[model samples]
Target: MMRTRFAPSPNGPLHLGHAYAALVAHDTARARGGSFALRIEDIDGERSRAELVEEFLLDLQWLGLEWDGAPIFQSHRLPGYAAAGERLKAMDVLYPCNCTRAEIAAAATKFGPDGPVYPGTCRNRHVDPTGAAWRLDTGRAMALTGPLEWVDEIAGRRDATPMIFGDVVLLRKDLPASYHLAATLDDAADGVTLVTRGMDLFPASHIHRLLQALLDLPVPTWLHHPLLVEPDGRKLAKRRGSPSLGDCRRAGEDGRAIATALREGRFPAGISLSQGIHQTP
Candidate 1:
């Protein structure tokens, strides 16, 4: 059976954008008689909040979306991430990185697709690799995998070009696993067959496809939905004061009604959906 997941971080209460993303995965699974699961990405020790995790569940329940089994927490899966990191290290495709953000920014000559690609400052520093953030040598890894490709339900076939991110971080400075490593591993671990997310993340999928090849993980189809934007064309973000779903629920608004409006392409005041082409639900 098809399996999809709605994975959200517990750093803040979910907003309408998150609601639409989750609804896409939920309704897609239901439409195909597939399984829907929820995963809590709380590995960020600095920002993750236990209270927000509970609120996430409550908000989803209020939305009338049912998920299978208990929600998976990234915090509980650190050892697995560590193991994966070790595997990449053994393969010699990953190296220790010790450069600070300021140092990289100063040394970067030009920005790549994802911000300034690391200048590989520490790529040959010969420092002790332990307890340091790890980076995937995208060029070297791609040489091993040769050519690769992935399919999106909306955008169709795409050749994987992870080098655009340069040497991407596999383990973060503040956390054991980076989003590229954890999300890829988690999807395989949860048996997710379809990866549904926002169009803004379409580029990250390139890096993810490379990781799957390196780790020998299961491949899943992707569905990148349009983003929810403000009137100024800025993406809605919790850090930017976007209203949370809990706020609407507490205001006695109907969750199902809001979800229905989103599904039917209706928007609330001060909000607009992205102009990106739609994908089948």
Candidate 2:
């Protein structure tokens, strides 16, 4: 059975951009007669909110999307990440970094997709276990399942590779799994086969692919859809104060208008009468 997920960070509400991602995953799963699911990706402990998580679920349900299984939340799975990190550490693939955010910024000038991209500060430095974020050692690079070519039924085949995303973070100092580590682990654990998300995350795919290879997990087929950009071409972001799905629902918008707005982008995807989510028991 094909499986896919709509994992959203609960740090913020489901904006229009997220709605597109949900629609793509929801439609594709139904089209292929596969299972659709949801995963709460709250790897960052600082910003996650339970209310926003509720909003994400309500919004997806309102949009007529369905899930195949119980929602898998990352915060509750810290043990799995710790286990995977232990494996990589056993192989000397990880090292603790004592460098602070400021120090890393000073060492690295050019920034990659996720900014500064870490200078691998403690990749070779001996740091006390009491402090600092851990970094993955990439000196011994591992290859992926394939050359990373995947077809997005909408956008065609992509040839993106991992070089752009250098040594990634597997575990944070405070003991949280980085997005890469948590997402890869959850995808495999949940049996996901197709991953449809915004193109903004295309660069991160390489990082995720690397984790998948190391953990001996199946790398899912990817469909990197174009992001829902503002009129100025800037991609939507939760921090940008973009309206949330909860906002639409409160205004009493129906599902059809919300979906059309999501697809066309002519206007915001407000809630519609026909497409709103019916509460499930």
Query: By how many angstroms RMSD does model 1 differ from the true structure?
Result: 2.5
> Against the true structure, whose TM-score is highest?
1
Cα lDDT of all candidates, in order? 0.90, 0.73
lDDT of 2: 0.73
Question: Which residue pairs collide, candidate 2?
Answer: 62-277, 253-271, 253-272, 254-271, 254-272, 254-273, 255-272, 255-275
Deviation from native of the Cα of residue 222 in model 2, angstroms: 0.7
lDDT of 1 by residue, 1-281 (tens): 99999999999889999999999999999999999999999988879988998889989998889999899988889999999998999999999888888888899986765678898887777967666789998888999999999999989988998877889999877898999999999999999999999998888889999999999999999999889999998889999989999999999999988888989989889999986652222
The C-alpha RMSD in Å for every predicted model, in order, reads 2.5, 6.7
**lDDT, candidate 1, at 43:** 85
Model 2 CA lDDT for position 229: 66
Q: Report the backbone clash tally of model 2.
A: 8
Candidate 1 C-alpha error for residue 81, in Å: 0.3
Q: In angstroms, how far off is 178's CA in candidate 2?
A: 0.3
User: How many Å off is the CA of 25 in candidate 2?
Assistant: 0.4
